[model samples]
Target: MSPLELHTRALELAAGVIGTVQPEQLVLPTPCSGWDLRRLLEHMVGQQRGFAAAARGAAPDPALFRDVPVHGDPAGAFRRSAEELTAAFTSASAGAAEPRLRLPEIRDGEPFRLRHAIGFQLLDTLVHTWDVAAALGVPAGTAAAVDRDEPLAAALLDAAGLVPAGPADRAPGRAFRERHEAADGAGPFDRALALLGRDPAWAPPAR
Candidate 1:
């Protein structure tokens, strides 16, 4: 699938999960360590805007990294950010050979290829979709969402080999907790989550 298509589907899945978040559940912990449901949503909003800014060839702005406030209507705020993100990517320059993006997290002002940026966003969006669903005590995988994620996982895996293998090989400034090895008979989605440093079996602690 094209990066645009993959990214659209990932955002759709995340929106689905976000739409189901209950007011009382915002405080629940998610699969992402140290992030509660509210924090995760805030991060999602920030990421959407940040990536959208990158697609526009704008320099990274620290202001764009601020978390979205969860007051009033958090879901509405997310929907707005999602729309902006979609618009930015869809309208990107098609003629540019290797579009360059200035990602906020990089700090070094180094530009990355548009496709590469989209791939990282795609991976992050898919994983967080699961994180949101799990925090809500709902199943993250629908047959359709899994179908979309499977191909994305395969693409990421192919790219992973080019990254040096070791603890130091982790994405700059991002530390993955100990990886949970998938069981022998694990399904494609489970294996994919594992490869991305997520435990497929992760759930919120029982209250």
Candidate 2:
């Protein structure tokens, strides 16, 4: 699958899992510290909208990246945001001669190559899908077809390797925390998650 296809699939998988969330489940804690499932979903939708805006060359607006509150039907909100993002990316990819995107959320609104930026979004999508699934009590590997997504996992791991691993880079408020060590005999998804600062063994707290 193309990068876009992989990203779309990941987002679809996230939407499917999110669709199962009952209103009560929104209060469940996720892998992201200090955020409940509702907040995580909001963040996911916000990022999708923000990235879609960037793809359309929208001017930098902090509000664009802020968590979008989901009112009715959180699953529908997520699916719509995903579609908008994919559509914007498709248009930008085809229409632009240079294809440079202005990403305000990163590096003071630096312009990034469209293809590279898509990779970043893909990594974000893969990790957040895991986050929501984990919050819902889905086994780590069972979320998003860990085995079938090996290619995406491998690609994300490689992309993560390009990120700086210094203390400052992993400091509090950073996009990712410090990398964790993967377990022995871990598969590609687990290894990639660990490399990207998520614990493959992470589970929701017992009620």
Candidate 3:
């Protein structure tokens, strides 16, 4: 899958959650432990902006919106943010040197490649999409076979070595625990998010 395709899919998955957020039901819990619908969508928007900034050779502003919507038009706002990220990733020219992802919590002193940025984005979108689904009882991960996705998951999972397992990968030999934990390992959603810069337990910071 190309980066653009991944970006588009990421947006599609994110969009799938908009209706689930509901107009006044923003406080509903999502698959991510601590975050409600509003908070999770905020984080999603922040990620899109931050990733795009990085692609533009700028510092990642994860907190680009320090005080974003806790409750508002969840669907429209999130869709716009998704579009912004898709455009950013698609238009930016980082050349051979991929942008270096400096996510302090996930890992320290690690510089990620450019293509990996798209991969990372895909990972987060895919997992969070499932989170939204799981919390709202929506179905996901039916797009492709796990065997084919393992390679893509492997590259992103390379970063997982430094972090502790999130709720998704706590058990061994499980569906999402990763079949390749020895640096060459890979798996479905949760493992992929671990490889990217998100917490499997990703919750919103306290208000």
**How many Å off is the CA of 29 in candidate 1?**
0.9
Comparing 1 and 3 on lDDT, the stronger one: 1
lDDT of candidate 2 over 32-113, digit per residue (tens): 9889989998998999999999889987676898899887578988888899999999998786384877777666677888
Displacement of residue 45 (Cα, Å) in model 3 is: 1.2
Candidate 1 error regions (>4 Å): 106-109, 140-144, 148-175, 178-180
The candidate with the higher lDDT, 1 or 2, is 2
Which lDDT tens digits does candidate 3 get at residues 40-91? 7777676666676666666434355233563578778777777787777766
Q: What TM-score quantifies how close candidate 1 is to the native fold?
A: 0.83
Q: Which residue pairs show collisions in model 1?
A: none
102 in model 2: Cα distance from truth in Å? 2.3
Error of 1 at 157 (Å): 4.5
Question: Quick one: how many clashes does candidate 1 have?
Answer: 0
The alpha-carbon deviation from the true structure for residue 67 of candidate 2, after best TM-score superposition, in angstroms, is 0.7
Candidate models: Cα lDDT each? 0.71, 0.79, 0.56
